[model samples]
Target chain A: MAKQFKSLHPIKFYRDYLNQNVRPDGRLLSKFRPVIVNTGSIATADGSALVRIGKTTVICGIKAELAQPKAEKPKEGFLICNVDLPPLCSSKFRPGPPSDLAQVTTRFVADLILNSGCIHLRDLCILKEKLVWCLYADLICLDYDGCLIDACLLALLTALKTVKLPSVDYDVAIDKKVVNEDEKKSILIYNTPVSTTYAIFEDKIITDPTAEEEDLSSGLITIVVKEKELCSVHKPGGSPISEEKLYDCIQETIKRADLLNTLINTAISEQTH
Target chain B: MNVIDDNNLLMRKVNCKLDILSRPDGSVLLSQGDTVVIAGVYGPIEVKTQKMLINKASVETFYRPKSGTPGIGDRLYESIIQNICETSLVSALYPRSSIVVIIQEMQNYGGIISCAVNACCFALLNSGIDMKFLVASASCALDDKGVFHLDPDKLLSDKAKANFVFVFDNIAKRIIASHTSGSFNLAQYEEALELCKKACDAIFDFYKTKMKNEIANKV
Candidate 1:
């Protein structure tokens, strides 16, 4: 029966593959699945990107709106990022308010954006403390395989790079702001952050675990790196991992981040050309 | 009687791909011009006791906007899609069950409601559900000069005096649902309706070709 196969086959197949030091998809224990990124695809949003890691797909759309700058952060703008995991992606989630996993993922992604400091908030300010551009990045998962954090990070970064803001003009007599659509400018990105997730099962570390692997893993860790700097090391407490394992994960994350940086740069250039 | 500087007006070409997502029971990504919609169909599986109906299946639809939280505007589209699906699908075959259709907006240059309706039909077809007849929808906009344009883009739709989205069943070529925005006189509304009915023919042809090609590729 389909039910029996669904529950038994993945466990047995994964265990056999692990014993052989490989994955069910025929990759080494530390090998990651392929990632693909497409930028500026959505017409409604000012900027958008679609990212796919293995079978996991995520779409990030960035909409720009104008609002008053916070008095405390007079020269700075704001960035709002939300991650939505609807039931269309997988059967694990139902339709309603975001589930616990979604909330956790959303917080992690928001923290990653703040800690990475890839974007300069000051640049979004049109008239300091008066009017500022508010960028809202809405990332929706269309498929749930595994490694959602990595896909979201990649999509968000690419979508930001594709954003083009219209020039604003302040009319003194009219006392109103006018947006000039003919001349547009792109946002400056200071750093490009990429995240890598690993699942630990039976003293083995698996990179880019699938949905099934995630459920079976004893612990999960996500390492975020931007160039040589470490932004965040997220381990939400399932099983304690040793320092040596953590170090190994960080090193792997650095290598992956470097590759992703180059990938994103190439995509940006390809679009511009 | 038409008045306007002429030519260079054509409907944006529509492109579609079926079964793009693996997790959904039925899925489709459909784009008309620059507007794109992704639809997923799941159902005839299980239903809660409260929602279950003894005589027929319960149908539900959720429409998500491109970004931000879904608001009252999206609910309007959801109801339209639900009604069209209820009309086309043979729910009597699966009683006490539920069928869910989730539509995600990818882009919206114009004709968004029609695009969503078309995508839902494709998703339903991909799911292999029992349907009394295949359905297709088209939107026609009438400009200030009384000229009817088929599949108008956002620029035209914004300036149009009136626009209407018509959903038609393939069997009798009768309109199953019609949604109108802006204002038009009786004669203008009838002209737009006739234009959309004729446009549906081309859309139906597109559906046939796409299915035929898919079947050919499979074998």
Candidate 2:
């Protein structure tokens, strides 16, 4: 369910804020809140991460299991992403199946995964036609103050960076002379796909829509990007956007992606030690 | 959970490694794939009596989401702790007093409430607050594919049976509070109790290490 928050209706504030473009939060439209990323924060899973963007908080975890490959993608393993916004997070959501928002988010994640090159499909394949690793990327929003896409991206990136697939262990062991039984190491991560969402309202393109802004938004475009490359894009509304606005969005995303990736990479690195 | 997660078997449950936090009186970070949850505990300080003395120490729980904000889960947590806290703690002895149980959720992949209980137990003990018999573990309904997953992360949790209600403390050991959903067959109920026992034992090991190091760190 969409959040039921209303804009503060700061008409004067907007005019002044837009002139110099200083947000009430003391940030430019392109500037995001202080971001924090932490990985290995969830012990029960193979890998986990939490990302907080200002007031928005998102958590993502990766679970890889042995499964059969798809009919077409038999050589490479498959990945599934599911997003959940529980009723507890907001009264708007009731306890039930995946909502429309979740479905969209899931699709967004799949696009991002493909576009960002976060995981190597080859490494996920355990054996040619025998075994494969089906990684389940589950994203959960504990709170939705605003800028959910950015927070989700932050969480997803860190979770991917910190995930470790256990080494394959053989049941056979030699007595006198040690033997090998096709042992394998951890799964390899290729690149990072960061999702950047921009909410448009009243001819203004807000980089990271807060709760109020999201409520009053005309439409939003969430783009998934890899290093200096566009991976996927999710624009829900049918609103006709300008080429300038689209290009502007990408430019802001490039800068934002760099910052996000750095934050997540550094956090994951710290947890390793 | 079986009713849920049926569509995508890949989106099922997995074994959880409970207990992972340095601070807090107790901590447990549970995960189900990409859904992560870090639960921390703090408190058992002085409380008010006659605030409705029920011949037991009152248990007060505060749940803070990852963003340091309060949402609807806070209500569920407050009531859950209130319902189970008395039975979990030596409430009768400290009547008119209070035991503050604060749970901070760092990330919630799914089945977080159960993980919260597990964290609460560890946190209460981590705080070195005396309690009654050990409070067992808790987990939600398992997923489809006949997989009785331990902790249903967000994906599995959202699809659980209506009455799946989240079993806590286990039957074989001791139960602080559990939904009287009355849906589970006798055998299934018994199995859940056993599962909690195993989960409890495993989590306690982590708690032991956390408490030892936390106490030592102070020194």
**After superposition, which runs of candidate 1 have C-alpha atoms over 4 Å from their true positions?**
A1-6, A9-13, B1-219
- For model 2, the stretches where C-alpha displacement exceeds 4 angstroms are A1-20, A169-185, B1-219
lDDT per residue, candidate 2, B78-166, as tens digits? 55554455455666766656677766666666655666666566556655666654454445454444345454556655554311323
Clashing pairs in 1: none
Report the Cα interface RMSD of each model, rounded to 1 decimal: 25.6, 22.7
Least accurate 10 contiguous residues by lDDT in model 1 chain A: A234-243
A155-273: candidate 1 lDDT, tens digit per residue:
99999999999999875467698899889899999888888989878778899999989987855777777777666555543343454576678778877887888888888788889
Give the Å error, residue B167, model 2. Answer: 50
What DockQ does each listed candidate score?
Answer: 0.01, 0.01
Name the best candidate (by lDDT).
1
Candidate 2 residue-wise lDDT at A189: 70
List model 1 lDDT by residue over B49-81, tens digit each.
Answer: 988989899988889999998754565577667
lDDT of 2 by residue, A12-119 (tens): 445456567666567787776777888887887767898887777888888877776777777788777777899877776788876645655555556556645567
Docking class of 1: incorrect
What is candidate 1's TM-score against the reference? 0.55
